[model samples]
Target: MQQIIKFFLRNKTFLLYVFLLFIAVVFTIQSHSYHKSKFINSANYVTGGIYNSVNNLSLYFNLESQNLLLQEENARLHSLLSTPNYSTSLSFISDSIYSGISYKFTPAQVIKNSYSVKNNILLINRGKRDSIKQDFGVITPKGLLGIVDQRSNKFATVLSILNTNIKISAQLKNTNHFGSLMWDTKSPQVVQLNEISKIAPLKKGDTIVTSGRSVIFPKGIPVGTIQDFRLDSAENFYTIDVKLFNDMTNIEYVYIIENVDKTEINSLLKPSNE
Candidate 1:
């Protein structure tokens, strides 16, 4: 401290000049409206540029949070818009509410996903705490993502649609024909739906979607478009290549569907087998 005092005493002349210059600028701005206006404008310009650069730097790190927020909003909208009206107990595909099935979506973030492996799986950052659980169907806004295979309090693992073990009931849109959705394990973009009846009308671009044949997923959730089709050697069913609506390799967020009456549905099936 004493050394610093000595140094300041030695350079007091320069310091005094710097102090005087600061006083002169303040006085000039105070005395003249034009000078004050110019000073304020210059300060604003410099500070504005600084703040903008800082905001951009911070935004680059906050993209994941923004993405999750968007997914949450989408899920909320789906809760309202896509929810089926359950009225009749007979048909599953009712534009009105139907008694056979009901579901709600839980938005989730994909912290890890594997598409190249033969048994593909996705680890999502939503779990029992968020009402996500095993057997829950996962989907993005574009299409079906997969099925939840396991869960903890704060995380869930999904058997991705790209997995060879992944099988879900699906059907052609605008028709009652149903098939089994399966992945070939060769490409993440394509999956096959087998057992579509030969007599059902198969168009080049017909949409495929969840069939509600089982309780895993609600009917009419988009699967993909028919890319190509041909009868197997058995000639009893159509093997169709469906171009998936969701890009599995690039998924970041998804919605977990919890069938509202899954237990009741499963119990009824159990009694039939017994």
Candidate 2:
């Protein structure tokens, strides 16, 4: 306290000049309309700039939350579309037996992704607690991503479509000619569709999609467009190079699809032991 008093005594003349200058400036602005207007405009400009900067900073921090909300909304919309009676006029539908809904979508975030290796895998922020299980199909708004291969209580691993070990049922759009979607470990942006019949009207830019022959992916989920194709050794099937819709290297958000009838379908397909 004594030191503060001594310091104020030492700087009293300078402090007094500063205080008088501030008072004079305030009085001059108040007395002159032009000066007052100029001062107000300058104050507004400074405050407006500060407010805008703060607002932009807040928005930057809120981006992750906004992305999460968008993912959830997307999942809801997908779930709605999977219902048997989805209509433009309807706002909601009950998931009852009469609703005939087979698929349920759960939104998830990718924590880790790999695409350069021969057997790339992805890790998602959903697991057993979120109803994620092995063989569950994962996708984004653009296209199919992969299938869930393993899960814990809070996380799951996906066998990415870029993996050579994974095979998915894909077909040419609007045709019965289907093949196994596989990766050639060559390009991350392209996948291979094997066993497609050569006589199935081969053409460049033809879209390929899920066939719905398996319990994993629903029918008509886009895989890619036909980039190029070539006949195999025996000339019986065509090995198609499909340009993928999703960029596997940049996956962030995903939807885990649960086919509710999968267990029942698998049970029926199992061989019976008499």
Candidate 3:
């Protein structure tokens, strides 16, 4: 206590001067309208900045929830768009009989993704319990991702487009020309489209999409854009390189697509001798 008193006494002259300066500044601001306005503006500016920082921090912490909500909304939108009678004014109807909806979409999160192997696979946070099944098409907002190949009670595996063993039926946009889409294991960003007829018009940057020839994916789902093309050794078909829109290595959210009429279609195509 004695040491503290001694220190305060020694610095009392300077402390007094500081206190007087603060009082003088306050008086000057209160006495002058311009000074008062400037002081108030400065105070407001500081408080506003503090509030904005707090708000931004809150938003950052809430990002995961916001993203989940967006994913669900996107799934709903995709379901509506896949319907044959979809309209802007139409409200979503879950009943297939009433809406004539042939496809259903379910949003899922990629719990694990692999793109560095010859046959890449993705694991999603949904399974048989969620109605996910083999041959269900998977996609992102930008492009196609994969198809579900296996499922358990609470999880499912997808055969990624990057896999060498998987082949998707794809066609050039605005035309009937279609080919088989496969991965060459060279680059994750590109896939190869084989068996496209040489007579079909080919151009760089031509958009490619699902052919809808199979019961897996509906027609017109985006695949990618043509990056390059060349004739095969036989000169009968063009082998085109496609630049995928989805970054396979960085996928997070996806939508699983179910074809409602798939069973009926498959049944009709079965061999009669069987």
Candidate 4:
């Protein structure tokens, strides 16, 4: 207590000056309209800066949640847009709500991807637990990715379009001519379209998309663009080189499509005579 008193006494003059200065500044600000307004503005600027900084810090930590929400929303929209309508029969006096949606899209993140191997495969975070199954088509927003070939309870493996054994039904955008899309194992960005007739009116920059004849992907889903084409040994079909829109080496998120009527279609197509 004695030391504190001595310390205050020694700084009495300085303390008195600080007190008077604070009072004079307060009186000046209150007496002048411009000064008072400026002081309030200055205080607001400091407080506003602090609040903004804190808000930004909170947002920075919530990016992952925001991204997941966006992915889910995209999956819902994709399902609505990509599902095919298979209603061929209509009654004159209709009282039924015809839901055109016959397909379901499940969003998934790629945990593993391979492009250099001959039989490249992709591993995704979703599996049979998420209703994913074999033969489901995998795609990104920009283009086709792969097909689901194997799955467990919590994970699934996709046969990438870069795989040589995998073949997809693809057709030229300008014509009805369709062919099998396959990888050549030579380049990651290029694939081959076989069985397209030589005289299909193909152009250098023609777009190729899914044929929709299969139960996997919907028709008109973009696959690639024609880079070069030449007649095969028999000259009946063209071996087309397609430049892919999606980079095989760099894939992240994908949507898996499930055709709800796939089993029914397969049953109808099955040949009982054989």
Candidate 5:
């Protein structure tokens, strides 16, 4: 107590001056309209800055959730666009069963991806629990990516189009000339399209898309644009170089597409000679 009194006594003159200065400033602001307005403006500017900073921080933390929601919305939109058109040859019951072809799109995050290998595989954070299954076509908003190859209850592996074991049916966007899409382990952004008839009109920068001849993906899903083309060894077909729309190495989110009519389609396509 004695030490405190000694310190306060020593600084009392300076402290008194500081206190009087604060009071004088407040009185001056209250007495002058311009000063009061300036003080209110300064206080508002500071508080507004603080509030903006806090709001930005909150938005930054919510980005992941917002991204996921956007991905899901994109998947839904793609699913609607990819829905198939059924044929008119089926009976009423079959038509009812087939009912304007359906698709199930499950959004997944790419937890791991590989582009340097011949048989590259991508791992995703969706699996059987999410209805992701083997042979499900995977894609992004830009274009096709790959197919799901293996799965557990909570995770799945995708066989990238860059893999040697994969062959996707693709067609020219301007015509019905279709072929098999494969990768030669040469480039991450390019793949090979073979079995296209050499007589088919193709040009540089022509677009390619899925054929929908198979049950994996519906027709018109973009594959890539033709970068170049040349006749195959037998000279009967052209082997095309396609620059893929998706950059395989930079994939983050994808949609797993399940053909709802796959089982029925496969059953109808099976050979009956046995």
Candidate 6:
């Protein structure tokens, strides 16, 4: 205590000057309108900067969670694609189901992913309450994910594009030749475009995308472009390999597509078979 007192006494002159300076600055701000206004402006600027920094930090921290959510959505798509009947059309003839079409997107997040297996699945965190249901189409902003296979109130499963059984209706963007898209299980980034007519004038760089013939997706939903392909045995068709637009490894937010007229089309097709 005596040492502290001695130190304070020794620095009393400088301390007094500092104290007076502080008081003078406060008084000047309070007494002068211009000074007061400047002080308030300066204060606002400092506070605003702090607020902005805090907000940005919060946003950055939330990104990890957001990414996890996206993975879940992708997982749902993978699961749905695993189902055999996802695109096993009842139409044994020309795909007339494309006649009546309506589609809507319900957003979802993927939580899990698997592409190594012949059959792949993606789990998403959406359910019936969000208008998600079985057979709904899933896609990201970039391209197709898969299809929704089933759903509960809070979660759903998807048949991811990586799944072997997943079939998407696709066509050459420049021509009317359409076919079913499936995975070869050899490369995660590539899929097979089946039933493409040998006479479709296809080349290595030909772009292929969703035909959107049905209400499942909008027309021109990008699937991929032709990489390399060969004629199947019997040589009636070319199974062109497509490079998918959406990178299967990094999928996030997805829009679940519901065909509003699916029931109507299914109902109409019943009697044609008989």
Comparing 1 and 4 by lDDT, which wins?
4
| Lowest lDDT block of 10, candidate 3 | 34-43
The estimated TM-scores of all candidates read 0.65, 0.67, 0.67, 0.66, 0.66, 0.62
Q: lDDT scores for all predictions?
A: 0.76, 0.79, 0.79, 0.78, 0.78, 0.73
Supply the global lDDT for candidate 5.
Answer: 0.78
Tens-digit lDDT track of model 2 for 42-154: 11234434433554455565467557756865897789899988675454566455456779999887766678887776767777777777889999867899988766566
Q: Give per-residue CA lDDT, model 4, range 1-274, as digits (tens).
A: 9999999999999999999999878865553321122232211334434433554565555567546646865897678767687333443445456455668889887666679877777777676679887789999866899888766666677788987667899999988899999888999999999999877998898999999989999898899999999999999999999999886766666799999889989999998886
Q: Write the per-residue lDDT of candidate 6 for residues 5-121, one digit (tens) a residue.
A: 999999999999999999878865553321122232211234434433554455564587557656765786688789777863455455567643366667766655567887676
Error of 2 at 138 (Å): 0.3
- Candidate 5, residue 257: Cα displacement in angstroms equals 0.5
Query: Which residue pairs of candidate 1 clash?
Result: 85-96, 85-97, 85-98, 86-97, 86-98, 87-97, 87-98
Would you list the clashing residue pairs of candidate 2? none
Write the number of the candidate with greater lDDT, choosing between 1 and 2.
2
* Candidate 3 local distance difference test against the native: 0.79
**How big is the positional error of residue 266 in model 3, measured in Å on the Cα after superposition?**
0.6
lDDT of 6 at 123: 64
lDDT of 5 by residue, 48-88 (tens): 34533554455565567557756865797777767786443
TM-score of 6: 0.62
